[model samples]
Target: MPRHVAIIMDGNGRWAKQRHLPRAMGHRRGVEAVREIVRAAGDMGLEALTLYAFSSENWKRPAQEVGDLMGLLKHFIVADIDEFVENGVRLKVIGRYRELAPDIVALIDDAVARTSENSRTTLAVALNYGAQDELVRATSAIAARVAEGSLAPADIDTDAFADALDTADMPPLDLLIRTSGEQRLSNFLLWQCAYAELWFTDTLWPDFSRAHFAQALAEYAARERRFGGR
Candidate 1:
């Protein structure tokens, strides 16, 4: 099985619109899908599952929508943290997540601390995340170290650069799945998924189930990874 997998949960609003429901309803349903997928990932023995929860660019969305998203995030943490601890799933947040609302940040910190010791699986959520922003931050840190004479310019290799990323401690990405028929990365995990297999499905985020997830894994198993070698 692929050790690490990440997903771009798209089409929540579209799903709601299609059903003549409010966007918030779609997001709520999407959270339910998140719960199911996290459990499936742990049951399948995946080392890590990273979810693109919110991107830095998402701030441009309507204020009400953004607020609702934050509320859902808080609710998800409060509601699901116990299960995470019980199931041995470690909670991790990537990107500039600390920039979120103070209360939300506090909740995330508490949840992360509460589940820090779990070893079975890592659930990494990307909040306020953007691959380009992540890369810039990582590069800036590396440059600062070089300026301080603590690191040499010649030492900046792929491994060194990767170590500066927010996902440095997580397993290498082995597969990346995007739902809602979206075929683009949308600025998610550009660095980590460099060699990961890509999978896209028309199923919307709220409609994504364990069966769809299983199909992706089965397809992954049948493929050969060349990793730049024949």
Candidate 2:
């Protein structure tokens, strides 16, 4: 089995439009899907699962929608944190998550602290995340170290750069799945997924199930990863 898998949960808005329901309703259902998938990943013995929860660019959306998304996130953490601890799932948040609302940040910090020792699986959620922004931040930090004479320019390498990323402690990404038939990465985990196999499905976020996840894994098992070697 692939040691790590990440997902771009898309199509909640489209799903809601298709069903003649409010977008908030779709997001609510999407949260349910998140719960199912996390449970499934743990049961299947995956080492890590990273979810693209919210992107930095998402701030351009309407104020009310953004507020709704924040509310949903707060609810998810409050409602599911117990289950996470019970199932041995460690909670890790990436990107500028601390820039979120103060109360939300506190809740996230509490949840992360509460589940820090779990070993069964790691669930990394990318909140206020953007690959380009992450890269810039990482680069800026490394440059600062160089300026301070604490690091040499010649010492920079892929490993050194990766160590500065938010996912530095997580397992190397092995498979990336994008739902809702989207075939693009959407600026999610660009650095971490450099060599990961890509999978896309027509299933929307709210409709994604364990079966779909299993199918992706089965396909991953059948393929050969060259990793730039013949």
Highest lDDT among the candidates is held by which one?
Answer: 1
Count of clashing pairs, candidate 2: 0
Clashes per candidate, residues 3 or more apart or on different chains = 0, 0
Give the clashing pairs for model 2.
Answer: none
Worst 10 residues of 1 by lDDT: 221-230
Q: Write the per-residue lDDT of candidate 1 for residues 198-226, one digit (tens) a residue.
A: 99999999999999999999999999999
Residue pair clashes in candidate 1: none
Per-residue CA lDDT of model 2 for 67-178, tens digit only, reads 9999999999999999999999999999999999999999999999999999999999999999999999999989998999988999999998998999999999999999
Give the Cα error of residue 86 in candidate 2, in Å: 1.0
